[model samples]
Target: MIGRWIFIRGQAMGRRGWLALAALFIVALIVLMPLRMILGLTMPETITARSVEGSVWGGRIGDLNAGPLPLGTVDAGLEPLPLLIGRPQFAIARDGFSATIAPSRIIHANGSVQIPDGLGGLPVTSVGLGDFSAAMADGQCTEAQGTLSLTLAALGPLLPDAITVSGQARCEKGALVVPMRGPQGMERLTLKIGGDGRWQADLTLAGLPQETVEALKSSGFDTRPGGIGIGTSGTF
Candidate 1:
């Protein structure tokens, strides 16, 4: 009788051990699932990519684009700790720059991206962001902090040489605003981005020679008493 009791107890314990191991296996499988499987469900509509390959813990996104700007190929991964608390976060890195993205905000390190289509109607060559961050609520900007730089490409000899301007980024009336000025402070550019991905850019050149002003006017700029202004708007 004693022997039978001991045997029965041993069998039950072994079954319990196996059940625990099976449970752990299932959890591991779910945690390391491929990103391609869940990308459509987790990715934001404002961001798109040509291809996603690898597991959620670590993956590569090909030909990624933020609005209309290209981000090239980037390494990305999901933060598991955030998901446990119901707040999903994504970490992205490319060209030695990194950023963290949450549902309503994004934090960036120093980085620059080439503007293939320029900005609005201006022939912008590139954009550089330094410690830039922005938060949004209800389709509008709630907070914006950082510095921004833009390189305006020269339009041959008809226009001045390529010039870069630096300025602060801030929140203005719920829109994210960036005001950049060249070294001489004669060249200015303002950019605004809405939460819905719509954007507009305005460039003004002041104190230029009359000859140069006429050249700019011929290049589609509007002649104004203050200076020559060029404006364009589009959806990201």
Candidate 2:
């Protein structure tokens, strides 16, 4: 009778060991299965997603931690998996220009562009831009306030001898408008280039040079009566 009892106790202990092993196997499978699926994923169409609210856990594994994401978002329309593991590329249209950018929370983009021949045409081919910044606001595109330097090799053959115009411009009416200052000592100057190849400038010269005053007298730039002498040299 004592031997039988010992044998029964050993069998029970072995059964308990087998049950524990089976439980561990199940737990391992549960943990690894989802990770495998996530790693082997691909998306062919756009995915709409919302933030996960609470924590989740698995038995004998661990609690999963997920941070807050944007509330409601529509990803790129191509599907399988909406999230990309690596850098993404996309295009944005704003202010009459379309820009291609790297897809990220904060993106850094660099590319070469050509200014179009007309007011609204494709960009130039050889001209380039460096360190351009853009941001997404309310699901729309907005260019960040910063300096953009542009280089053009040949501007349509009409510009004066490959002229270089480098200055800061403000974004207005879907264009970059730069205000050029007049010549020295001139408060204001107006220049007009007509379609018939005629060029003219209206200038206000306050403290005029002696040579310029003499020339004005000869060329009829002097409009004042009684031989008035303007006391300054400037352009308007």
Candidate 3:
């Protein structure tokens, strides 16, 4: 009788062990499902992409666009642990550049992209996002780093050479601000972009040839302390 009891008990234990293993396997299946199943379920309004393909562990986002900027096709992968807690983090990359995107922060490397409509009607043909990183908490900018550049064209004879203005990015009054300067500091452009896609730019010109200054003034630029200034605002 004792031998029979022991055998039965051992069998029961083995069954429980198999049950536990099965439970773990089911959880893994649910967590590792393909990302394509949920790609468009809750996409943000400010972001759009041509398509996505692959598993949650590794995927691709094709022709992604953030606001008005186009981010080329990028490889993406999710951090599974974070997803478990409802805060999904993605590791994204394209070409040689990489970045991490989370709920409250974004970090990216330098990249040059063309702007179809330009920036706030400033005749900017292209924009370079150089080493940009920004973080937010409680709807406020907590940290910011990196620089940005804008290339301009169609200035007629006023600016024969290609004009590229660049400057470091910072946070001010809960907005991302970039104060760019042209060669020789002869021109200044302060650009601000808010979280809601609203943007504004102030362009000022100084230390230019008298004829250049006159030309700008004739083009609706107001005379300021150091030179002529123009302000424009629009949605990004």
Best by TM-score: 1
lDDT of 1 by residue, 27-78 (tens): 8997788876666676578778899999877999898777776778889888
Q: Please rank every candidate by lDDT, starting with the best.
A: 1, 3, 2
TM for every model, in the order presented, reads: 0.87, 0.25, 0.79
- Which candidate do you rate higher for TM-score, 2 or 3? 3
lDDT-better candidate, 1 vs 3: 1
Once model 2 is optimally superposed onto the true structure by TM-score, how far is the C-alpha of residue 224 displaced, in angstroms?
A: 23
Better of 1 and 2 by lDDT: 1
Clashes of each: 0, 24, 0
**lDDT (CA) for every model shown?**
0.83, 0.32, 0.78
Flag the better candidate by TM-score, 1 or 2. 1
Poorly placed runs, candidate 2 (over 4 Å): 1-106, 115-126, 136-147, 151-159, 166-236
Model 3 lDDT per residue over 1-236, tens place: 99999889767787778788899999788667676555554335566788888886788999877677777788988777767888777778887456766655667756777777777657888888778887766656777889888888756587687778899989999988889999789879998877666789888878778888788778778888988888889985
lDDT of 3 at 59: 89
TM-score, cand. 2:
0.25
* Per-residue lDDT of model 2, residues 1-236, tens digit only: 99999889767787778888899998776444432132124211121223212111111111211111111211111111322555333332222223333332223334433343411121112332344454433334334433233332332322223322222333333322332232332322222222222223332334545665566556334544333222212111
